[model samples]
Target: MTLPLPRQRRTLGRTGLQVSPIGLGCSGFWGHRRFAEGAAGRVLATALEQGVNLLDTGHNYSGFNAEPRLGRLLAPLLATCPREQLVISSKGGTLTGQAGLGGTEQRDFSPAAITASCEASLRNLRLEYLDIYQLHGIGEHQITDELLGTLQRLRERGLFRHLGINTHSRGTLDWLAANPTVFDVVLLDYNLLQQDRAAHVAQLHEAGMGVLAGTVLAQGHLLPYRPRLPALSDAWYLARAWLKPSSRRLMRSASKMRRAVASIASQAPAQTAFAYVLQHPGIAAGIVGTTRTESLLQILATDPCLLDAADRARLVAVFGDGRGSPSV
Candidate 1:
């Protein structure tokens, strides 16, 4: 499928921020050392040129080096275009000081800690305020008056324009259902191999909150072609598959899709995989993580063909969509 390069932009909730259908996620990118500066520059340049405006990063991404790297690379680019051409976003609360998710992670959602993390991210990114600031993988029990109050204060102080959460907790989802207006956006894993959050995303959208879908290619598990990057290499995903129940479950689904996709369509499953999630009504952008310009180019070229019941069913059946996964 050949999508119009740089697909049309969508507004994030009511924030008045315009974002591309495909955005760059900075997780597993910009580690402190052993990453080539030239390689990252190429990817960032291509993305900005292609009109991908949203960049999602967490405070702990790449051992706390992602934001600083982005700051240096993106500063000149922002000057070339309008400063508002990019929608900068970052997450805090999980101060693991490591690149990829695993057992060594540490999480803190206290008022002072969350506040300090946001401030540090601003300094690292060298920005006045982020367009969106999310709580990195926060659980329901962590949501509280003190934490919410601190975030509210941060927004009022112009540290961040919006507050969002990256989560898969049922309890947090239920809380969002009750207080739909509290947060302005959500970052969640939404893709063909996993569709459990399909209905939840739609509900969030209907309530007027923006959605940024991550891991749209199942952590490169479903991509026909994947680039090599330290800390996010094949070994990393393999480790993820072993440690995470969801990853293990999706591995089974990816296997089925790999065998079936070639027979059904001319496009690679990676293309179809992205389209499957982009067509979901609520998503402001599909936040794809990549350090290679070629892979980013492939994502920029996705057309998101409208899917009928059978086409949808064929894809969804691989993972068995629960509660009728989001479809075109």
Candidate 2:
């Protein structure tokens, strides 16, 4: 039997912003290929029309073009949807305009760089202030008193309402857990194949900071094997996928999960993957960033997807935190 999904919103930490269970990630990194304006705009329109109000983007997404693109598309939507109703969160700290296709992003969380990036993002999005502004992919060391002071000054200046951070590091989460006052939101990488940080997610929640799971789809790697791309997209995604060693181990064990999962009859693997993430405790929403509208539709189709205790335990036995078999 098909279960109905919830249409409610969850509190985004102490910021008091209510967001949908599915947030649209505007990274524009689909295979590192060019995303046409028409298609991108269509994705944005369809998402909003379908009740998705959270748009997650960053300063360097799509080589520094995602923000402006979103700006142009959002202008028309604002005519109907109140700006406050849509929670637009963006990240900076990653250096923009760097050469190369899907190469490493140089992070610049320095006060000067962050200040400039936030200001430029405000200008690009054509907004007075962002709902949430994050420091993209920085370590705990970067989260110093000076950085706090810098963000405080910017927040005081009305650049943004809440502070956020985007990271895949558990250590970073631990640091934030020790000092949850540092940020109001966290964009984390958690998916069926990468579940090691589940506990830390709860910690952030306990500390009153919202957690948005990024890469919930694992860059589409969690799906069964598919044919190679004709271009560099596959190469880029594969290379970056190795960055998460645990995921690498999980990929080795993926064939086991590729088999039929119990209780979920005839459902798509994409939906199952999404369900596992959203159902995880303390996860506000799962962020999906695909250029294809169909992919987003599939994810939304499973809004508040269900995975009972048996399903959860079975997933752990299979994925095992994406780490190899338990140590002896």
Highest TM-score scorer: 1
C-alpha lDDT of candidate 1 relative to the true structure: 0.76
lDDT for 201 in candidate 2 is 84
Candidate 2: TM-score?
Answer: 0.87
Q: For candidate 1, give the lDDT of residue 55.
A: 88
Q: What stretches of model 1 exceed 4 Å from their correct place?
A: 1-5, 29-32, 99-104, 224-232, 240-246, 306-309, 321-328
Model 1: per-residue Cα lDDT over 1-328, one tens digit each: 1112354888888677888998887767434445677787788778877877788888888778888888888777555565666789999988777523444468889998999999999998888899999998788778898899999999999999988998756678777867888898888878776677888889998998898888788766675544545454555446756776556556655666655554457456667778889888888889887766877887788877744457877877766644222321
All candidates: CA RMSD (Å): 4.3, 4.5
1-328 in candidate 2: lDDT tens per residue?
A: 1112248787888888889888898875541326567877878767876788888988787778888888888877676656787889998898854324444467878899999999999999989899999988789887878888999999999999999998877778888999898789999887766666778888898889998988776666667665754545455456656754544655665566656343355356778878888786688888888766887788788834466667667877776644432210
List clash counts for every candidate, in order.
0, 0
Clashes of 2: 0
Clash-forming residue pairs, model 2:
none
Residue 168 CA error for candidate 2 (Å)?
0.9
